[model samples]
Target chain A: MVNKSISEINNRIKDGSVNVVTAEEMVGIVAELGAQGAAREVDVVTTGTFGAMCSSGVFLNFGHAEPPIKMQKVWLNDVEAYTGVAAVDAYIGATQVSETLGMEYGGAHVIEDLIRGNTIDVHAISPGTDCYPRKILDTTLDINDLNQAIMLNPRNAYQKYNAATNSTSQKLYTYMGSLMPNYGNVTYSGAGVLSPLSNDPEYRTIGTGTRIFLGGTQGYIVGQGTQHSSKSGFGTLMLQGDLKEMDAEFVRASTFTGYGVSLYVGMGIPIPILDEKVALATAVSDADIITQVMDYGIPTRDRPVVRGVTYEELRSGSIEIKGREVTTSSLSSFKRSRQIAGILKDWISHGEFFLSQPAERLPSDTVSKPMKQTRGTAMVRDIMAKDVMTIHKNASVFDAAKMIMDVSFNHLPVVTENNILVGIITAWDISKAVAQNTFDLVENIMTRKVITATDTEQVTIAARRLEQHGVSAMPVVDEQHHVIGIITSDDISMLFARRN
Target chain B: MKIRIIINRDIVTKPILAEAIIETGIPLNIAQAHFDSTTGEIIADIEDTEYRMIKNALVSRGAEVLRLDTPINWDEEECVECGGCISVCPTKVFSMDEEWNLKVDTTKCIQCGTCIEMCPHDALSLDV
Candidate 1:
């Protein structure tokens, strides 16, 4: 049974009667303390949402066996009777538990309330779960006993977290199904892990596990065609060059089209770059053009011309000119004029017909150029520093500050024995802790929440992640939560220079 | 020499008529009226030969040709008080009889078969 109220919890913290714990061992320690009436509220902070889910599962399953009260809303004195079970199973069964316990499962809101109410006597935070844990714990706990727990199964940590927090039911089931390795092995799969669905094209797999069948087609225009004409009355002109040349031309054309379309369509619609041009006319001898016009009894413009029109307007018959109907024949003629103008422009610029131009030779016989490399590439391994300095949850803030200065490092990766990244402690955190005069414990000064990257990721991705999150540095970790290296803005700057 | 080829054949076969509504404005039922198989000439009630190119393109891609006919025009006065044209038109070209006996919203009409089939008064007939 819980004995202390919100005010009494604060009083215990003020008098130094209660000590904050951040380790798995603190689970039993705080439970015992709570039972002994050391303080009514025992705040449990985990590393992240995943850590919170896993720890909450363990606390609810194991701590509830002793009937430990899990604090919900500290201000409202709302408490839920917990049951001890594995974090994964507990998270999966959270909805059922909420329904059975008649409690509102408001995700991280419940955790937030517990911290604000100062009911949390101990916080067991997992490193990569929530966005902020250090701030929450520092405000509530004694900050000295904040120990990190390295869990054996981090995938289970993620699965349990996602299952409890994600809103989509189908996504939850898909995640659970993915966890099944074989029979009942219960292997956990990470998020965004891809797997083959089915071989049959008739029933195609769409989004992850979702599948849809191929349907039959119907229409008058079954296939599309390119419309081109020759002004020389020959009907055939070199419309497209060799594949490579055509591809290069297409790239340039696409760039122009993208810019033009973006200007016309605005930034919202992503317009695809088109390679093929709508040829309105082919190059014709001046004599043939005059003869053809006379033979066809058609009116001729002063300048010899051919036309081209976009395929979209042709199919839809939706193009209009100043509130007047543009017939296909008229459009074809107009396109011819534009094509002629384009060809004339190209000819005038190059001093030759664009179609008849010879390809330029490559400088393959020339000596290979020497490349200038940056510091990051010159000393890739040295730039990747290892054995990063860290501080324990229970270490004194003064000691943590001394260690930071001693190691000549600004940031430290907080982790447990099993090598799970728990949190990050920075010089700034220590400074804040010193300013607040809470330097007595590491938990009080050390940042309990941290942004981290995986070791397998590229430094560019790491840099982008840092930029996106507005962080100066990040701890690189392995799947087992072991800190491998620390990435900083300096390293990223070198990487950017090398790339450019 | 400009050779005028008359194709008296169905532009779209029955099997693929449903898709014709979305891909081409010509309805599956109406596509049959535009072609003349005997003369081998298509007197298509299309606005012009652009539709002919579209039909030829479709046929070249394995769509079977059947018959062709001129498109139908609706008599505004004789059109029944029923609003079947409004509901049946795929493009929603027709509306309720307000100022006139029957109003045709020509802009929205895509020449699908629904409005022609649903009209009970037989007031609507081929324009060409």
Candidate 2:
């Protein structure tokens, strides 16, 4: 039941008597001392993670142009920056590719170059207005020339994430790195027990305004990150820091083979062990934290989970999948992560850093949901043509061929006297009729077993039916078997075009 | 000393390496090898003193041999030691020490270029 406030810990740190340890060290300390004893002895536990985070970006305030142009479009070193905000203020996303260099260079590269004190080419355009009347401006500037450069990541440290493996025969190039064909390898990204969010799984001390170490400089947790799902054990953190104070060694740019560029960020957080529960939470080991291994080969919103595995198993360099042993690799840097944690621990022990109580706690029960799609709801009646060309069974083959040739139609429905669909004929069928010398009637060459589409069927289902039956068109019918209309692959494609 | 030998299609099916080993009477440790219908590549480690003898024997057998003095270059300054090369390297060239520090054993590298291609920092290269 030992309890301590952040202010008390700060006072102790100021007195040069505070005890702090890294999350990795704290695991052994807690195991030896137990949670209650550890809470009484330890003051803080620092956690860290260094991994590729694509949702990270920096916002820059480039002061103002000579004539004060409202930058509608902007590019830094040929990489585009989002100018949808205020004038002269732009956000460069990490994954945005370069117009000239493509994926070989990107916004992440520009950020890295700026951090390294390299000059960057700044290009901008504006639809000139009276208040801000500059048409185009191109200039070179470095990190020192900017008014403000802030790194505001929407999502940075994931608490834990699924491991990725490919099940397909061909190699897969993805944000997960290059997955070898036929499960040749497995790639996982996380700092495991050293991760910040994993130490504060319930977000007890990690929330809005919580101080953190961002890329070698002190930063703050802005809020719960995008897609933060603590219920499923994949919590994330949104962060903000001053890019000017960051070290180039802690921030890097990476280009995934077929995927675009992403920023590899080094981040750390100091968890104040206020109570026994907090101490126990920080004691979580790799074996205690479990995550699923997903098959990235499916390429769907819901990739199939191959199996549940612990971080200890993933870190062992190999794991069993479907009765086959597969080698595992890591995209996140554990060495760098340990270094970050150690640095933070030293800062706190020297009283150079102090933790802050969160203004608000993050949600612990939320789950990330898939995007709701509207395209699959379209019915066959919405895209089918009502004016269907039909031929009677008693009609001559020449008449059927004439109707199909005149409209450039590939298929024609053969119906009875009451206009009920009984068979279907194609231009190929007429050509066969000529080759076989059977030019008497349409029924002689028509396919009697017609694959028909109901008016109420979904457009996607109708398209699948067309593919399954190997037909170009299908006659839409009513409950009474009346040929109401026709659906073709072209019509479905046009509908897709319109929707897109 | 480690060397990589490439046997062409004309003599790929023949036992050139075994014949060379017998002729030189030098124990050769075959670390890795890959064979296709057109060609075959074999990487083996042998004693440094017998390097010339094996080279002559392999050359006499019409097999192209190259000394793997520097198969890959690691830029420690740029590398964050992400372990992205551990699984892709067929020979387990990269590993984590007990302290979780990255350790690289270039002796096991087959020069397959998989690690160089997969490195996010562009730290690993075959330029050497």
Candidate 3:
């Protein structure tokens, strides 16, 4: 029943008598001595994670211009910044893409550029008001010119996250990186044993106002992040720090091929060992933590979980998926994570860093929810044409073409006598059949692998599938694979048109 | 030493690299090789002393060989030693040293170019 307070730990740190070790090192210490023994021996356990945190941004107060214009809209280095706050204050989100430079440059790039001491071009437009008369301003400013540059991230330092793999046959570009076709590779992003929240999984030591290392400087955990779900083992932190004091080495900007830009943030937290329970929690290892490998091919919010895997299996460079071995790549940097933890431990041991009692403990029972869309919430069944005419697989190509032309439809579903969908034949397929001089059964020319929509599926998902497969329409099928209806690009466009 | 050999359309059918390896008695680790009907390109690692010998043998066989000085450029100054490139690289071009610092063995780089895209710092690029 060893008990110690943060004040006691700070006193030890001040006297240069505190025994500080990284979470990775604490694992061995706890294993050597029991948790109770280790709690008496160790004072603080440092943890770290360096990965692409897309929900990061900064609040900048560019001092008032000479003419004093109220900035209604602002662009920092061509990347848009939300400027609805004050006269010259704006919050630059990390994921905002550049208008002129496109995905090549973004808000993350602008932040990194500022941290690197590079000058940024600031352009703003304002509808002139009585008090503030200036209309437009274009200027270049460095990080030094800003009255306050604060890095206030909404979500960061995820305790654990799902590993991503593609089950589809197409190369899927996602925030998880380029997932190869047919589960060719897997990518997981987290620092496994070295993660900050993983060390304090219960949010016992990490919460509001907990002192932390943010981008190589001292920072604080503001509160739980936007999607913090500690109950599901994927807790997140909201952090705040002085951006002007941040080191460029710890802040970086990255661009995913099709997904746009993100910011890689380096974050560290020191967990003071108050008791044996705290010691045991801080000693958690890669093998102890479990996370699901999600199939990223599914674009829906609730992606199917492929399998449960331990971080030990992930960090080993490979994991088995459906009995086949797939090499694993980590988007998070473990090497840098270890360095960050080591640096935090050094700072604590040298008395440069101190632990603090959190102002409020993070909720352990929180569960995240999907965003509710206010518009475009229609289901596929609502807009799909009902009782669509179908051609039999045994029918000739000419019959399919005649059915498509007569019904004024570009695609016709080939079905069995029981109305079970077998394939789909487009007018283009019939034309290609005629050009090749081969007029045979509709099954021979029909596309065997047909993209389909379900009655219960959201229209947005069906639309995405059509666009992904490069098709203008899809057969709406049921659980029995019966062609119940058909939905086309025209039907979707018409729905939006009616809504407007 | 790493070198990229470009076999012309006429000599692509012949085993120029295999013959060069045999002539110089140096083993070649071919990291990446692409072949078509008209042209062949190979990037391989060889001993430093045998580079000139292999280049001369390859050039005699109507192949253009160039030392690979800048195929994949890793900017050390900008890199924070993140291990983002380690697992994505098929040929194991990146690894961690004793201090958990990133180490790059460019000889094994197959130029898959995934690492360049995966790097968060934009610290990696292909010169070609």
Clashing pairs in 3: none
Each candidate's lDDT (Cα)? 0.31, 0.91, 0.89
Write one digit per residue (lDDT tens) for candidate 3, span B64-126.
988876557889876766566775777788876766577898866666687887776678999
The TM-score-based order of candidates, best leading, equals: 3, 2, 1
Q: Estimate each model's TM-score.
A: 0.24, 0.78, 0.85
Give the local distance difference test score of model 2: 0.91
Please write out the lDDT profile of model 1 over residues A396-427, one tens digit for every residue. Answer: 77877889889988887776766677778888
Off by over 4 Å in 3: A372-376, A392-397, A414-423, A429-449, A478-482, B1-71, B78-82, B86-110
What would the per-residue lDDT of candidate 3 be over residues A193-253, giving only the tens digit for each residue? 8989999888878889999999999999999998999889889989999999999778898
Root-mean-square deviation of each candidate, in angstroms? 39.4, 9.6, 5.0
TM-score of 2: 0.78
What would the per-residue lDDT of candidate 2 be over residues A150-251, giving only the tens digit for each residue?
999999899998999999876878888889998889999999999898998888778899999998999999999999888998888899999999998889
Per model, how much of the real contact set is kept?
Answer: 0.00, 0.77, 0.46
Model 3's CAPRI class is acceptable
Query: A102, model 3: CA deviation in Å?
Result: 2.0
Candidate 2 DockQ vs. native: 0.56
lDDT of 3: 0.89
